[model samples]
Target chain A: MELLNRAISGTMESSDIMVEIIPWDKDLEINLKSDVKEQYGKQIIALVKAILDENGVKKACINLKDKGALDFVISARVKTALYRAARRSQ
Target chain B: MFDNFSKKYIYSQNTRGRKTTSDFLKTLGLSFDENVNITINILDGKRIIATASAEKNLIKCIGVDENYRSKGLMNTLISEIISHQYDNNIYDLSIITKIENEKVIQSLGFETICETENIILMENNKNKFKKYLENISKNKVANEQSSAIVMNLNPITKGHMYLIEKASKESEQVYIFIVSEDKSKVPFETRVKLAKESTKFLKNVKIIEGGDYIISSKTFPTYFSKNVDEWINNYCNLDLKLFGKYIAKELNIRKRYVGKEPYCELTSFYNKKMKEILPLYNIQVTEIERLEKNQKAISASLVRKLAEEGNISQIKELVPEATYKYYISKED
Candidate 1:
């Protein structure tokens, strides 16, 4: 219930993050070897912008390896990964 | 409106202005008389990105669901919201949250102080919160003479002159403090000199340097970062503790004069705190509504930006000829 109990205070650093999402639903699977179109990257980036914009992260470079997870799952994974990455940077 | 650290990115992202559909869902809602109105959208297109709202002063709420996570949507939305509030004079803003939400908020320059069980009161500065309401009640009516005017004259300009003139007419003495800092384009001393010269006809006014304690941008960078409320409580609380006695002694000033900052959230908090604290010192707080030209509050920043673009003509209209010439010649 308590998603954040620790101090989120510290300096921010940059690095490449390859996020892998595993969906609870099996139907979400897609081509793993398909070349990701530039547009898809842009779409994912838009989603990321929404998250960061809502959250207020200015200095960060995130890399994602999507496994076609559901919306809630993707959000949790990204938030967890971002928190982890942020902790590592600190 | 980005009254937190993430405001910088919003400023950067604003330049790109991408396109998409879900972006329409980024409706920042405002409720008035129980009517809900959707404000600006944060996305470029179809994606429902992050969203933020500041109808609530102490805390502006921002929400970004999962699909929008990781791309800085929340940051952008919050930044934009904060920027909007700052532009509208809503300083001394804050965001309410539980302990777990610390990282996301702190990185954006929010300072956390314990407010209640499990609720961390993250604010920017505290000194600015000492509202002088008690003093106002005690004083009953505002005295026309001996009012104290405080300002962050980042650069004193003609519009500022108009404010000083207005105060001089109403008060017997106006104590003006020019903010001093190394990053200032025009040194504090020079600003004080210019301000003094421009208001030379007013014998009752006096100008002094705002001590490092009050004006250091390092102490409170929210003005530029758009994170004024993030640290305003801490700044105000600390300052009130530090300057409480000093302020009581120096001017014996019963009324503190401040210019209306329509765009900064912290200023509103300041007005609130001044009203709260002045009663302790038996002082009162007065706000001078801005004298505007072209519907814009004449400000030092506008002057500096205009001067940078060689737009001294308009600058002259807001400032005295001597001050206008000073800025123009400095450009040369």
Candidate 2:
């Protein structure tokens, strides 16, 4: 799916990660900032990559500000942001 | 998330907004900044708990309710502000945050550009300052004496041309940084075009668009919690410190040239302050006498005054061909 305008989802609240997706020309670049980066950084990045790959998103710059969110919550926010990016501005 | 947490975008036109914002900031030991364009308050029903305000692209006056600390509220606060700015097509944003809150802001994707004893300057995109220097690095010439001159050039005049011409003769290479702020009678684009057209003949000169790093008195806030004189001193010194530390080092500008101001007290004071401050970073300030016509110093302000009177002949004598043609066309 082609990402349209820059879309943002979720909040900075605890147990939630704010996801910002902007169209990039080159490739999918995920910039993650998480409190649990030392422990779950790889897993969180891998999950974001898998989700973008599944959606056939070829190019994007996804910025994630994580405050110890669970995997399900992270996936939901990224999916929502990607979904919003696909739609025209409302 | 905190219960009943609702954010309000305070418009500049709202009158009661001032009292409420000041009351909220007073609790945090900070005061309301009057220069804010858009201010957002995270309210708990009737009371303001957290707030942040932006003056154009520079975010200042950030205060969160003390009781709300360490609760991930900043994430919501900053992301909202960042997204708000994105909607306006302003991606590169800066914040003049207090020195204490540096780490927290850095965690929220703001890279520190430079920090003083009190304030830390940060931006959203990292390595942008580096990139600004690198873009100009292409013009960097190997020279024993490379000098820099910063000018507003509201309208390029013979005085400005004479200064650059003299600097070009003395130094191996010269850089003319056209001030980028928009507080001038003449627009930035026209000034730049005139500066280029007048000096296109000088082989040793390069004209650069002074970006945000070049802080002008008008664009910066005067809310440094110091007296007027102290704040002005600190402001000019800090601006020179940035130039000396970053720009001079990157471009090998060992000399900074300023035309002696016989009129504006502020310009003369800046020249004096530059002499005192820039040397600490190993850059020398050289003051030159302004070019004279009819035994009076030729100046942009003088040209502007003549233009106001529609004095074509007098304006023609003080300005270059490029500026004279522009003035004639503009007066038309």
Candidate 3:
């Protein structure tokens, strides 16, 4: 059981987005959750695929909490969750 | 025997000691122990041959020993068999062989795409339908405010719809990058078409083909395989070099959007790695919360499983209404 407390704050520019992933329990299993404003299906999927392609993840448990985050913020939260999930136990 | 050479021989159901998916599945690190009838081509005993026993799509794996070179034996065996099968509409054929053995295949009209450093991706060029979708990010679109969205869509699902829609709102323009590799369960073309059809109404959204250079088997190698670490590094480099800053620079688009996938460990790692790499190119990274269904992260794999089992009803809850309808229509 684990929880991720993360703040991915950023502004969108230059096709680049940054995120900070902080986890309350490093061992918590992850699940993925998402909700986008209507009409952006392809873009969202592409973004997810890009991140997955970078990480080489075929499958894992992840959770996504979305707040209508812009691309930059969206990128941030995703990076944060991934960072926590992939963090080596300290 | 020669008259029956080109004919496909299915060795009956429950054939003892035969394997169906072992070879192809092994390449992906998936395992299954079951009896599957083997498909063989017997060319008058001059050469022994094997093929994947699938009805709609046929995947052929060919192997010959060292001593049998230059005898024309292999040629006679494959040419006689595959030509007949191709004529009969077993159109999707793939031959997997060692990377170094491309010479033999090249003479047979096969083009090799590198599956790995040591593995070759060979396909018959006779009637391969090629569809080109530009990396909009790489194109000189003349718009500095445009943004791009990239996806693997291993299997497209509804939550994916939500994320894309959200990203579209923040950008004046959006480009969708689809991973083009045959290794996925859903064919790349099928996934691309799905993405296109699902988002066809978005006025500013453009569907672009993410070339195999960045995320295909030829580029990323199967990270799920034995060489996971090596594949991981390959993926990072490919993203940083090809997809990250370079592509962003190409379209003169400064903003890029991505979705959240916490269900997959590899994806999670990718989000982290991209964050480190984005700064070099002045790209920003966004990680949207993954959509949930009954408190579970939505996944394309889950949708595929349910679809395969004919449980289309369950998928609607996980995907958008339009996407679910699209999936059901195409699948049914």
Kept native contacts, as fractions per model, are: 0.00, 0.57, 0.00
DockQ of candidate 3 (2 decimals): 0.01
* CA displacement after TM-score superposition, residue B211 of candidate 1 (Å): 2.2
For candidate 3, the per-residue lDDT at B322 reads 58
What part of the reference interface contacts, as a 0 to 1 fraction, does candidate 2 reproduce? 0.57
In order of DockQ, best first, we have 2, 1, 3
lDDT per residue (tens digit) for residues B213-238 in model 3: 44532234341355666547555645
Show where candidate 2 strays beyond 4 Å: A88-90, B11-36, B44-49, B64-74, B225-234, B261-269, B291-314
Whole-model Cα lDDT per candidate?
Answer: 0.51, 0.83, 0.54
Residue-wise lDDT of candidate 2 within B258-309, one digit each (tens)?
9998987666777888999899989888999988998999888888888888
Candidate 2's docking class is: medium
Query: Could you give the candidate ranking by TM-score, starting with the highest?
Result: 2, 3, 1
For residue B51, model 3's alpha carbon misses the true position, in angstroms, by 20
- B102 in model 3: Cα distance from truth in Å? 18
At residue B315, give the lDDT of candidate 2: 87
- Tens-place lDDT per residue, model 2, A3-76, is 87888888776788888898979877889888899999999999999999999998999988898889999999
The DockQ of each candidate is 0.03, 0.60, 0.01
lDDT of 3 by residue, A16-83 (tens): 23222334533433332233425554565467557755765544433333324466656655655565
